[model samples]
Target: MLYQEKHRPQLHFTPKENWINDPNGLVYYEGEYHLFYQRNPHSNDHADMHWGHATSTDLYHWEEHGIALAPDELGTIFSGSAVVDKNNTSGLFESASGGLVAIFTHDGESQQQSIAYSEDKGRTWIKYEGNPVIPNTKIKDFRDPKVSWHEDSKKWVMALACGDHIQFYNSPNLIDWTYLSSFGKEYPSHIGVWECPDLLYLPVEGSSKKEWVLIVSINADGPNGGSAVYYFTGSFDGKVFHPNEKPEDALKWADAGKDFYAAVSWDNTEDTYWIGWMSNWQYAGVMPVSPWRSAMSLARKISLYEKDGNLLLKQTPVIADNRKEAASYQDVTIQPDTAESYAISDTAQIDLRISEASSSTKWGVKFVTDQEEVFQLAIDTQENTYTFYRTEGMIDFSEEFPEEIKGTLNGLDVQNLTAIVDRSSVELFLNNGLTVSTNLIYPQGTVTQLEVFAVNDVLQIDNVSWTQLKSIWN
Candidate 1:
């Protein structure tokens, strides 16, 4: 009966109690995926930061291992990355196959970088005696070091968030570090401070080349006015990162939704698996959930691709194997200004494909409960935008919770889209995640109806299918 609390997510990762934000120390080792997060162990609110640990063999069923790193004299733990020192690089292990080393931010009189190691697969951790390996340089907003090994440079590279930009540094054995160069001078920034920075090399789709991607998460002034992650496609030398300038004037968001912040990728995985904190700072402390206050987004497989001579990132969910197909439809049509409704499971994955349609049309789908709770997604072809709103659900927890968020389609045809609806959230992946929107919704009644409608023009549904996702709590 544990985790059966109301509004709990059945398919995502959430701490059993207290509060969690900014996923940290994501790594895979010895057939287990380790997810450490910024946790407040004493309350359901954000405070007294610590590193909470969990492990999963399949990344779906997680087992909590309690607190892995506690608040010490140096300060409470902030956010950071973890790596496997297979060659005894830090010399912290007995065998050549070294253990796990975590590079994180210690938040005390300012924020500084620190490290700890675990020999027994992250079951326990020992703080480094020489803590604060990288001291703060009088910068008030410095934290969240994401470290990775540079095979070409033969050194460990750390991407640290320093005030307005990211600072690059190189270390030989995860201990001594030297500053390299800084980025974000020419990049656009919002009204908020930057927190987490991740540097990743992703293979460009349809090409043999791989490009470097620098991801930065900003708060308070996102496109939707909360926490959001945006990135720049660039080239990273051992000493510096040169961003490839894009033609667009606005910031390129990783997720075009109200949620999805503090995103980071797992180290030492076969493929790039990215996850983010599934709540916004604007209302995270006031979410109307019990026992658990926040949850993590579904681990998504991300890739880089080229479109119109511009390199972009795409995200696709790592679907579980236990999902069952519940319904199917094909070649359905709806007249202008009309809608068709269907009953659906509370937890389900809906996939739909639209045939080539007129550019003057406006169509959408709405999820509803018997009590009139509603969450809607709409595509305006004339405006070349897709918009979403969750204004009719149980959204009174925060005054800032009710708003509409939109993403530009840029004249792309309405080909396909997927909506993964859980107990308290919905993840909309449009055009194979070339554009994604993730939002949290709370309905006092179970969402039992889905309605498809078109406005001013006919809508064509090429194919549609529905699958009921199994609950992990079961």
Candidate 2:
């Protein structure tokens, strides 16, 4: 059934056959969110890139539309962001200015930023004849336009991913863009080529204190292995960014997961929502099957909180409204002394809280198998931290040790963990949804089991619930 296999990690709505990657033009317009992506319309491989379009009332159930934009003599419609033009003022949408504006990279002979307008709310798009609004400045790998209207500046600002640094541009209208200064030059060692840049202002812990964040996905270097999102926390003073002191002080990865990449945020939304391509570069192009490739992480609502003087980004499921079928298992606890197992069908979400721990105890839950193959999320009470380890399974981990993939430990006194497991991915939220790690696992069979165990101390399972998820698209 897996055909035209693509490179990105996908959630529920994968077509039976096609190629998909790098979520583009993510915009909330006309009471629905529109998602465009990089796809090869004619075949299952990467060749002629086109913009594949889909829309959803909520982030979950998506309605696929025709190819939104294709390669012209001008170039292929590369990655970009979209905006809703409330007033029919921008001539880009001639008949109706109150439609949508798409700013993307046109990669013909060279890479340049281009603008396109949609009249019927993104159903159709017309490229601006006076194209290449931002000419290629000899920076070979320049693309992925993330544009937003800055209310304070009364203009549109763009964060374009340039090699090593993110280039900023200012525009009075959507058409004309002027190059501004670049950030991250001083911290060249900290990042590689920055791609898929997103800049937004968000409140800290529901407080009035708001800070602007510039998020860039680094393609060449990451904490895990491949690409990762690095953020800068600072204030934008109309023209340039005044960043914080240390790069790591302000820089942060979007997710502690293996599969997250090229994440972009929707524009002009009160609630901060974003989506990411969910496959790693290491595993791209080597998937088991083909015809259809790539997937998106479920849209996530983002928030910021500070713990131990470090800024952490929290992502929650934003597709709750589109959840058509949900089955819940409530208040199930296990004692620390023994190992217990429970059966899970296809896809399930579970929450666990482990209490009564000492310095020399281990507690965790295993998935997908009773022996040889299972994904494990555990806490070493002795180490006073949490760990995520996987045994023999769909992943061929014959060389590396099991503990190599161990994630950040929430310190001693860590008690709660919430986890969501679909067919091929696992997201673990530890210490009351504070620290998290996302991993991708291809389980061997359909009949999966949830197993839990503890070493020394009497492990107490405070609350455990597993909910079955129904298919979103038929």
Candidate 1 weakest lDDT stretch, 10 residues: 353-362
For model 2, how does the per-residue alpha-carbon lDDT over 75-193 read when each residue is reduced to its tens digit?
88889999876665466555553788899999889999998888787899988888889999999889999998888888888999887788899887888788888987777444467
lDDT by residue for model 1 (271-298), tens = 8998999999999999988788899999
- TM-score for model 2? 0.89
After superposition on all CA atoms, what RMSD does each candidate show versus the true structure?
1.4, 3.4
| Steric clash count of candidate 1 | 0
Q: After superposition, how far is residue 92 of candidate 2 from its true place, in Å?
A: 2.1
Candidate 2 — which residues are off by over 4 angstroms?
A: 1-11, 95-97, 188-191, 248-251, 321-337, 355-361, 370-372, 381-386, 396-404, 409-415, 431-433
Best by TM-score: 1
Error at 259, model 2, angstroms: 0.2
Model 2, position 143: C-alpha lDDT score:
93
Q: Report model 1's TM-score to 2 decimal places.
A: 0.97
